[model samples]
Target: MKNIILSATLLAMSAGAALADAHSVVRMGTEGAYPPYNFINDDGEVDGFERVLGDELCARAELTCEWVLNDWDSIIPNLTSGNYDTIIAGMSITDERDEVIDFTQNYIPPASSLFVALSEDADLEGGVIAAQTNTIQAGYIAETGATLLEFATPDETVAAVRNGEADAVFADGDFLLPIANEDADLMVVGDPVQLGGGVGMGLRETDTELREAFNAAIQSMKDDGTLNALIIEWFGEEAATF
Candidate 1:
């Protein structure tokens, strides 16, 4: 019986060690549909501002890291379930979200949220506004007098406006600015609305050590002005930083 007990203890230790090693290899979760933040390039790999920022953070933290694509709706739940170690997606830091998960210091400062539509005369107050489900934009729209239409993906929200299912789509200015600039048919309307605290890396509440490592890395980038440079590279000079 003693020998059996010892064997069980040894097995548990080995399993624990394996788990530790796996945790050391940070898995960054992102919604590959959000451009200028993260998206799948033509090469079918994660690329964008968050991709670049996440890689630098991992290098500074001395972590072996890999990117994992997750749908925006399930991103947080997956992180809490240990499907990934961190969410480097351009997720805003909000009080509601903080109740469920911890966030690192702000990497991207809060920026304006904009409304885009096929026409400049689109009604901003009473018209239908589409936003990605479970986003701060969705929450903000819900409070506005405008009818809020929620979609699962950012692309779908934009499509809703193009298809005339919604009068306009509201989202991060950084994400929508380039789209509006590129498409002559689409235009940004009304003044931009600033929402949320800022964008940050998401981690499970239990993963305090992992959060600290990322926070330190973020601070390092901020101190050296690398974070601001990357923000401008992807979001242009108008984007808020540090």
Candidate 2:
């Protein structure tokens, strides 16, 4: 989904100079809230599938890297402003977003978006649906007859449904399936919505060199089957891969 304000900034930066170098200690940005993708562990360190994948990527590309946490809403803005060198967040590659920032070839393939509710019969078509602000799911809901409620974080979107603030929460199936399986009160309510091209790393349009480096790294993982293994490890065997 696109935000007009950020789109303006992105367009402004698209023609600017590249901010990364081969020897630079690349700063990797993430939300540190969405689990299995990226999150802060008990040790207060950035930990998750992205963490491991990012580390390997850095090694393969022979670049030093450090993690930077940013709120999801401002992740792109911060990157454009040079707060980080790249976004290793589980961001989907979409035409609307490609207008703002460049994306590497997808590390995670296009996957289903599932609707989760407290009851099996919950109204999914016309009911109020919760989704994280600025996400594809939120954009999809806005086009439907259903009322869309936006939250700042993925957890908050799920909380909205649990607390009856919304009839259902829609998000990546990988993110919601674990929650649904662990909670007896929650269940998937409808067929999965296929959204976005796939999940990939976001980089400034000017950072072509850096993007190419990471792209090569990702391709290596894919060829060796490490990428698929990581997908299965974090999201189960059913999760889509490159």
Candidate 3:
């Protein structure tokens, strides 16, 4: 899930005016830390499902695009400041985020959030829970009987659970599944809780032209079944698809 702080309306207005013109090389922003969505590979290049998907979408939209890595906490701020043209990170479409920026129709459908812990018997409702700062999971935990521990990154949240800093880490099921499967010490602890609408590309409210281009490109992929194929290829056959 996604969330962001509101930037000054005047600043957004100025940036929008400057970006209204057609771009020669549209910049794509991401947090290259979250794996299977976006991450740095051995070659020192951004690699993962979003990297591949973003490139294809750009190609389809006939736009020359470059990738920029930003900290997740500041991604929206940088975008509003005109550091990048769009956010193709694994950002879920939420009204909270929409208050600061616009989003394309979700590329990934609504998915479940799950809890991962050192033990299968970890308390689901009252234990200390770890979640990445500013995420919907963190907000959700704050409302529950659990004590919420916030970390700067997803990896840190998982590390918290592993190191006994918290009872469990709550996060996207897709992001946690591979980790749980590979590690015998960690296991999923409770029933899946569906969260957010789905994942979408984040754009500035002023970039309607660019947003429409990517939306059309995404729709084309869905029409041809290529989007579903890419989903299954990256997230397994059981993964949800449009």
Candidate lDDT scores, in order, read 0.87, 0.87, 0.87
Name the 10 consecutive residues with the lowest summed lDDT in model 2.
11-20
RMSD of each: 9.7, 8.4, 7.9
TM-score of 1: 0.90
Q: Per-residue alpha-carbon lDDT of model 3 for 198-219, expressed as tens digits?
A: 9999999998878877777777
Write one digit per residue (lDDT tens) for candidate 2, span 80-121: 999998898889889999998999999999999999999988
User: Cα RMSD (Å) between model 3 and the true structure?
Assistant: 7.9
Over 4 Å off, model 1: 1-22
**lDDT (C-alpha) at residue 56 in model 1:** 85
lDDT of 2 at 122: 87
Point out the higher-scoring one by TM-score: 1 or 2. Answer: 2
Off by over 4 Å in 3: 1-21
